[model samples]
Target: MKLTVVGGGSTYTPELIDGFARLRDTLPVEELVLVDPATERLELVGGLARRILARQDHPARVVTTADLDAGVADADAVLLQLRVGGQAARNEDETWPLECGCVGQETTGAGGLAKALRTVPVVLDIAERVRRANPDAWIIDFTNPVGIVTRALLKAGHRAVGLCNVAIGFQRRFAGLLGVDPSEVHLDHVGLNHLTWETGVRLGGPEGEDVLPKLLAEHGGPLAETLHLPRAVLDRLGVVPSYYLRYYYAHDEVVRELRTKPSRAAEVAQMERELLRMYADPALDEKPELLARRGGAYYSEAAVDLAAGLLGGGGSTYQVVNTYNNGTLPFLPDDAVVEVQAAVGPQGASPLPVRPVDPLYAGLIANVTAYEDLALDAALRGGRERVFRALLAHPLIGQFEYAETLTDRLIAHNREHLAWA
Candidate 1:
């Protein structure tokens, strides 16, 4: 088995490499390629990846390349984790939207739309190159604005599946709380990427008894605190919202908080500098402790599971993934890419039928899905009107005045990345 990582220079690569080392039995990788345009960072990361494999005594060979086609040629799977513009650009994404009184984030709201515009095209081009080299290869996208990027890939007729660590992160957290194996806990995770709710937590499988109420009854306060939501809200909703929902539930408060603190991108940029320095060290054979704080918690496990299920032919095994709705949610269009529990196999992922959704969650999901549609349109078609329409559609930026201001900010901050700007 061969796997390619498109943005191997990212500080997150070590976490992925650590997973590849530990979960080699599951993925059974023979040749691993690290593809990146940043030669210096790639060399450091590649050296560390080799050291990681060597430390584990894994037989898989680590190769680094700046050539996308050569790196992906004949690969079994290609994982997309590239940031079109580095952290400096991300800092801009996270700061500009705040000027419009919207929560500036990399994967939601106006900033998210900006990222989608920049990311979708680059990811699609990479997908096209991967298809040209190996038509059968599966594309596992871990890019920001995953819903849009995955939808773009799927729409372009690529064999792609979107992977996010949110479900796995929740599973591990709930398992720790329940004193059970992570795999033994299954979540009724619903909604689109970065916008979801855990309506039910079951044991063993989808049909297992629901323990979500029990968890809330016992650990509601801690759970709510972790999500930065009020405990009363969780008790009232009888569900756990992903942390991203905080942007919606407390938009103004979050914008105020963001105004006071440094952008997440700035913090990450500092972390990357330290991590790259560590990666350049010959003695560092394992993933550094600092990498854990860099985030993408459990990303490697999620990627391994998806890749193993796809390449290893693990059929009908359920995993939470981002894929076509295909009527999984009766309220959503079939082509809408949603994040939910799905059975994984050689055929790719197909979401399981979702139980009926409460109007509270359904209303928001529908709203965001519509915004995503416009976001994708702007990402692909590229126009100020589309950007304005998407911002207007976004629940967090619904005012026409806010939309207009954000559209200009989005274009100005991203002129170099946007073709039609």
Candidate 2:
């Protein structure tokens, strides 16, 4: 099968290439196209991709190009991993929000809104191009603000599914702690993208016995430590929250921590420089160890599984993905995109029925879903008022003063990207 990666020039591409090479039995990729506007970075990443595949004896042909249409043309599946404004814009997204005394994150709060606005339009344009090229192709979005971007693609009637490494990362961790294979640990993962909880950890299948309590009873400390949350909180909540939840559960503390550290964007920029230098080494045939510190751990596995399932190849039957809720959460609108465990196939993903959500998590999910609605509006029809309203609606920046300030800063820092601004 043919596959295309729109942001194949990203430092993260080598990790993905490694996965495609190793998991050839799962996805069986033939032609692999790397599409990027940054020609220099694309060549560097492309060369490493080819070497990695060849080293593994995988026969996928690696092609690199700046033309989006040509790169995606007739592809079986197209993965979107592009950053509309690169790390510099991300630095602004992570920095300016902290000035409002709010959590500075790329996927939630004011910063997430900025990313959604900048990303949605670009993703939609690419989706349209892919649609024109191959109407049957599935669009797998690995971009940040995935819920908003995936919503944009689906609303525009594109065949798409959103993938995140969070669920797979959790599964792998839980499996290691439980002394079982990752596939045997099924997470009752639910909620919106980046804002989710592992309500249960079942073994064998979705209907398998729930071992979450056992996990918490034995491994709560390490789990909580990974989430950067106190063990007491996990015991009290009785569910493992994603690390991103730390931003919400400890907003002020997170903001304080963020203020003291360099933006994640800055750190990643430095890592990318080193990674590029490494990627340029002709002898480097594998993803560098330093790339592990660059994040998106297990992203390759998740992408492979999702793409395989979507294309009717051998893949995990059930996986966590972001797709239309379709009433999986009674509290959320059916059209709202939610991240949950779903049975994936050629027909697409259908989220499993979830037990009644506790009011604690349901309330927050509902609140963020509303914020995402406004974020998408501002992204689709940009205006100062729309941007301000979206920021005002976010649970993290609910105050008008903070919202107004963040809105102006967002537009100011991103004026070149926002067509209406």
Expressed as tens digits, the lDDT of each residue in 1-421 for candidate 2 is 8999999999999989999999999999999999999999999999999999999999999999999999999999999999989999999889988887988888889889999999999999899999899999999999999999999999999999999999999999999988999989999998999999999999999889999999999999989999999999999999999999998899998989999999999999999999999999999999999999999999999999999999999999999999999989999899999999999999999999998899999999999999899899999999999999999999999998998889889999999999999
Question: Model 2, stretches more than 4 Å misplaced?
Answer: none
Clashing pairs in 2: none
**For candidate 1, what is the lDDT?**
0.93
Tens-digit per-residue lDDT, 1-421, candidate 1: 8899999988999899999899887888999999999999999999999999999999999999999989999999999999989898889989999887889899999889989999998999999999999999999999989999999999999999998999999999999999999889989999999999999999999999999999999999999999999999999999999999999998888999999999999999999999999999999999999999999999998898899999864322889999999989999999999999998998889788788999999999999999999999999999999999999999998998999898899999999999999
Those runs of model 1 whose alpha carbons end farther than 4 Å from true positions after fitting are: 313-316
The local distance difference test score of each candidate is: 0.93, 0.94
Clashes found in each candidate (C-alpha, N, C closer than 3 A): 0, 0
Worst 10-residue lDDT window, candidate 2: 98-107
